[model samples]
Target: MFENLSERLERSFKILKGQGSITELNVAETLKDVRRALLDADVNYNVAKRFTDDVKKKAIGRNVLTAVKPNELMVKIVRDELAELMGGTAAEFKIDGNPAVILMSGLQGSGKTTFSAKLANLLKSKNGKKPMMVACDVYRPAAIEQLKVLANQLGVPVYSEEGSKDPVSIAKHAINEAKNQGCDVVIVDTAGRLAIDEEMMTEIAAIKKAINPTETLFVVDSMTGQDAVNTAKEFNERLDFDGVVLTKLDGDTRGGAALSIRKVVDKPIKFVGTGEKVDALDLFHPDRMADRILGMGDIISLVERAQQQYDEEEAKKLEAKIAKNQFDFNDFLSQIQQVKRMGNLKDLVSMIPGVGKMVKDMDISDDAFKGIEAIIYSMTPEERKHPSLLDGRRRKRLAMGSGTSIQEVNRLITQFDQIRKVMKQLQGGKAAKMAKMASRLRRR
Candidate 1:
């Protein structure tokens, strides 16, 4: 998402590339470029200045190690400062109450309603909490219905007083409903305006006062750039929210909001909406984010996501089948679906170390696996179970059924054979060691 900024930062670091040591002249030259990069990324001017100042104060007088290059040392200094500029660490999302009330605030079309459901899904699935959603956006037509639909998908309860315009009263009743339903978390989704207005601010403030929530989150569209930071400042002045939530972070945003919001409002970013899926939410991690911005990748987050989709029992069965050389199209398709469940394909790929920059210019679509899936779906049950049964004639028929050329079908069969061979090799030695580590992560 911060493609432009990443590129600019990379070029700026090149100014120190062959320098034998860190000097005031070289550091100043590199930081001038860094400051320009931050400004181009829409970062706040004062923040950019202070960030560069901090980096210089820590960098200029530092001794460059024999093994570490000047550029490498500079990168470490900048990465640490970037993390500090964000939030320094992950913020705790407190659900500590009889029924923890979380008041959601933001502008309309900021994906507030959608994120409400995402949060409910996360709490129910990960935190083992029964979350009840309260739709208090009575002024917006069908806002309550939208919350109901999202809550219904998660099998969570929804409290909404139809025909009631008083959001504060509705929120108060929703907490009671949550208590009766044995829900441990209550997320009240309030209405938003097209822009900052007195009536909108007053209504949400009253709702917050009535609910006395455990956590008040101000949601903002990250793609709005500087405007997102400005809106957060205004909201923080009124509600004094516990944290901020940046939505639409998966879009082509310059990432200014995420970099500047904390400095502006003095609040931790509790969460970020990565995609439109109900499970596309991620707890904000400033250090990992700083790594990604510097093109170092985020292996920890990638492993965590992989761990989420790992099933011990299923892995045992799959390992057994692979050992027996019985891995087929069905198993292949299952693997594809598991990867899909992890999140966006490109985002997942970008989490690996040093790979993000390589594929930054590639248009890796979520539908990259569509053709293979179609071809496999066209296969007969017997063909899927045993790849040996797929003769030339059968492949031609499958190609015709899947609207693909015969050559494409043949290529998939060859690729499947190669994958089986690789699995066989992974059953021993160094590969087996890696597999053991992965197993431990799954169990963790």
Candidate 2:
């Protein structure tokens, strides 16, 4: 997402490398490089200047710990500043309203409608709330349909009056519908409009007034860089949004918007859309994001993702199975499914410390597990349950069925045996717990 910025920041930090402490000369040169990196990342000129200046003021003459290197100390300083620059901590919103209204505002193509559905799904599945999506984008018929499709997929209700041109009226009726349906959360997906369009802005402003949303979020495209920041400012000046929702952060974005929007609009980034999938939404965490930008990785977020898919009872079952050497193809397939549910494979890999830099250039696809899944699926149910029953003849038949070579089938079986051995050895240790977590994030 911030690949270029991350690399540049890494290079900037290297200026302190081999130094015993943070001195004026070394810190100045490093700050210069850091400033240039921020500029190249499309950060606002004033924001970049203030950030580097603030960083310099805090960095130079700092008492470095005996065990910490100059570069490490500098990294800690910059990471803390970066976190503070982006909202010091995660912001909280009122989701407890009898029917909480969340108004979505942004320009077309910023993925606002899509994010609304994503947020609805997140609230529905994770927060135990009945979220009903209200399509108030009256100008765009397709937008309504899109929300409906996503709502249907999520099994959430959608309130829309087809062919109605009055969005404010639709919004009011939607709230009433929410009350009638006993829905606790009503996310109103408003029409996307330009910041310069006074009429459009006025329309949305009226809708916001009518609904009195508990949280009015301005959805922005992170790839738009400084433009996103400016648009956010314009919207905030008009509607005074409660927070920001950054969409398409998983794309090839320079990350200027994320770093600058909060400073410019004085609002917290509440959520971020990582991928196109409804499940790809994440609560924005500034410290974790700063860690990711500095190439240090976000192990906490990694563990959290793994934890979401980690089943205590299932893990216990597998632990018992591994202890008894009863791990089989069926267990392997189930583990693969858990990892797949964790979201993008490359994004998942990037969360591991040190692994992100190594595989930054590797084209790790979400389909990385397809071959392995196919091979397992080709196996007979009995063979999956009792993998030991797979003789040479069975392996050959399975390879043909899976459109793979016999060598691949043999290799998979060998790898599975090795994993069983490793799991057995790591049992009853902290390494085993981490191994189980990593295993849950593995693609295949």
Candidate 3:
């Protein structure tokens, strides 16, 4: 998401590379470039200046450790500053009260409704909360239906007044319904305007007052850049939102909103919507985000996602197969589906340390495993279990069935063999322990 900024920051750090030590003159040029990089990334002008100034202040006149390179030190300094700028740490959230109320507020098209459901999903599955989504977006046609669709996807109940136009009344009634239904949390999706206006603000304010939510979240579209920051500023002044939710972060190249909104509103970014999937929502961890912004990757988040997808009984069975050299196309297809569920392919790849930049320009699709999956699906059950069963004629038939060339089919088999060999080795060491741990994740 911060692709451009990562590249620019890498260049900025290079300004200090090969230098004898940290000095005023050398640090000046680096901080200047850093400030420029922040500005280019759509960071607020004052925030950019202050960030570099702070980094320069801490950096200048500091003695470089013999073990660390000047450039590496500068990178760490900037990474810390970046994290501090983005709220320093993840914010705390509350879902208290009989049916803990959460009011959703935002400008139109800020993904307020979508994030509402995402938040509910996270609470339901991750936090073990019985969340009921309330469709209070009365101004927008079918907005209630939209929330209902997402709520259904999560298997959560939805509350709405079919003919009522008063959002405040609707929201209040929903909370009462939630209590009656034994729902622990009530998420009220309030109406938003095309732009911030008096009427829109007043309506949400009245709703918030009537409901007296445990938390009020202002969702901002990260793709909007500076506009997102300005909108957040206005909302914070009026609503005093408990936290900010940055949506569309995966699609944004210049993440100005994420970088500036926390500082502008003096509110923590509690969550981030990394993709369109309801499960794409992540608890905003400032340190992990700073790691990403500096091209350091986010191994912690990557591992967490993997842990989420690893199935216990399945893992035990897969481990046994790997040991027996029985890892086949079926297992491979299963693995691919699990990986796909972790999140976007490019976003997942970007989490590997030092790999984000190399793939910055490449188009990494979510369907990266489509061809392999097609080839595997074309194989018969017996053929899939035994690779050697595929003779020259069988391979040709498989290629035709899969709509792939003979060469592609041969390539897949060859790669599969190599992967099978690697899996056998991986089952013998720390990798095996990691797999065991990951598989036992849900139980934890």
Candidate 4:
């Protein structure tokens, strides 16, 4: 997302490389480049200046520990400042009322409607809340249909009057409908104009006043850079939104909006849309994002995503199967499915420490596993269950069926076998450790 900024920041930090201490001269040299990087990333000029000043204040004359290099210390200081610049911590999303109302506000093409559905999905699946989407975009028929389609996919209810032109009325009625339907959260997706105007602002303001939403979020397209921040400021002045939502963060964005919007509008960023998928939504964590921007990766978030797809029973069963040397294509396919549910493949890989830099210039597609998945799907039930039965002739047949080369099929088999062997060895190691611990307990 902030690929260019990250690379520039990395290069800037190299100014302190091989330095014995954090002298003012070197610190200024490094932060000058840092400030340039932020400005190039489309950050607000004042914000960039203040950030570098704060970093300089904390960095200069600080006694560097013998174990920590000057560059590493500078990175730590910069990372902390970046986190503070981006709201310091994850903002709490308010969904406390019996039928909590959340009003979505932004210009057209800000992904407001799509993010409403994504938030509904997140609340329904994660928070155990019944979220009903309210389509208040009376001007756009397609917007209503889009909300309906998204709601249908999430199995959430939607309240919309087809012919009604009154958005405030639709929003108010939707709240009542949500109360009747026992929906705890009502997300009102309001209409947006190509540009902010008196009519659009007045309508949305009236709707907010009528519904009295518990949380009014300003959704902005991060790819728009400073324009997003400016729009956010105008909306915040009018609606006084409770938080911000940055959509299209996975795009080729300079990340100016994410870094500047909070500072300019004085609001916390509650959520970020990482990809187009409904499941690609994430709670905005400033520290984690700062880590990602600095190319340090976000392991905690990565582990949390993995834990979401982890099943205790499934893991035990898989472990038992692997321990028995019976790990098969079916198990492999199931594992792949779980990983797929974790979100974008490239994004997932970027979360691992130090892996982001290596793949920054690479085009790691979401379909990286397509060939293996296809090859496995083409296999018969018997072959999947007992992979050893797949001889050379069977592989050729499977290759033609999957539209993959025979060599591609053979490579998958080889890799699968290697993975199976490694998993078995790891399982054996765990078993040995458990046995030793048991013996120690008995002796005690």
TM-score of each model, paired residue for residue:
0.97, 0.96, 0.95, 0.96
What's model 4's lDDT at 69?
100
Q: Model 1 over residues 309-328: C-alpha lDDT tens digits? A: 87777877888898888998
Better of 1 and 3 by TM-score: 1
Ten contiguous residues with the weakest lDDT in model 4: 435-444
lDDT of 3 by residue, 1-444 (tens): 998888888888888889989999999999889888889889999888888889989998878889999999898888898899998878889887897898999988889899988888889877899999998888787788899899999999999887889988888888889889999999988888888899989998999899899999999888889988898889988999999988988885599888888777889999999898899999999999999999889999999888777678898888888888898888988988999989999999999999998998899998778888889999999998888898899999989998999999999999998998888888879668887667566566
How big is the RMSD of model 4?
A: 3.8
lDDT values for all models: 0.92, 0.90, 0.89, 0.93
Q: Write the per-residue lDDT of candidate 2 for residues 221-309, one digit (tens) a residue.
A: 99999999999998999999999999999998999999998898999999999999999999999999999999888888878787778
Global fold similarity of model 1 (TM-score): 0.97
Q: Which candidate leads the pack in lDDT?
A: 4
Question: What's the residue-level lDDT of 97 in candidate 4?
Answer: 97
Order the candidate numbers by lDDT, best to worst. 4, 1, 2, 3
How displaced is residue 149 in candidate 1, in Å?
2.4
User: What are the root-mean-square deviations of the candidates from the true structure over C-alphas?
Assistant: 1.2, 3.0, 1.8, 3.8
Model 3 ranges with Cα > 4 A deviation: 436-444
Q: For candidate 1, give the lDDT.
A: 0.92
What does candidate 4's lDDT look like per residue over 1-444, in tens digits? 999999999999999999999998999999999999999999999999999999999998899999999999999999999999999999999899979999999999999999999999999888899999998999989999999999999999999998999999999889998999999999999999999999999999999899889999999999999999999989988999999999999999999989998888899999999999999999999999999999999988887787777666677688789889999999999999999999998999999999999998798898988988999999999999998999999999999999999999999999999999888888868755754544454344
Candidate 2: regions farther than 4 A off: 430-444
* Model 3 / residue 384 / CA error / Å: 2.6
TM-score of 4: 0.96
- Regarding lDDT, does 1 or 3 come out ahead? 1
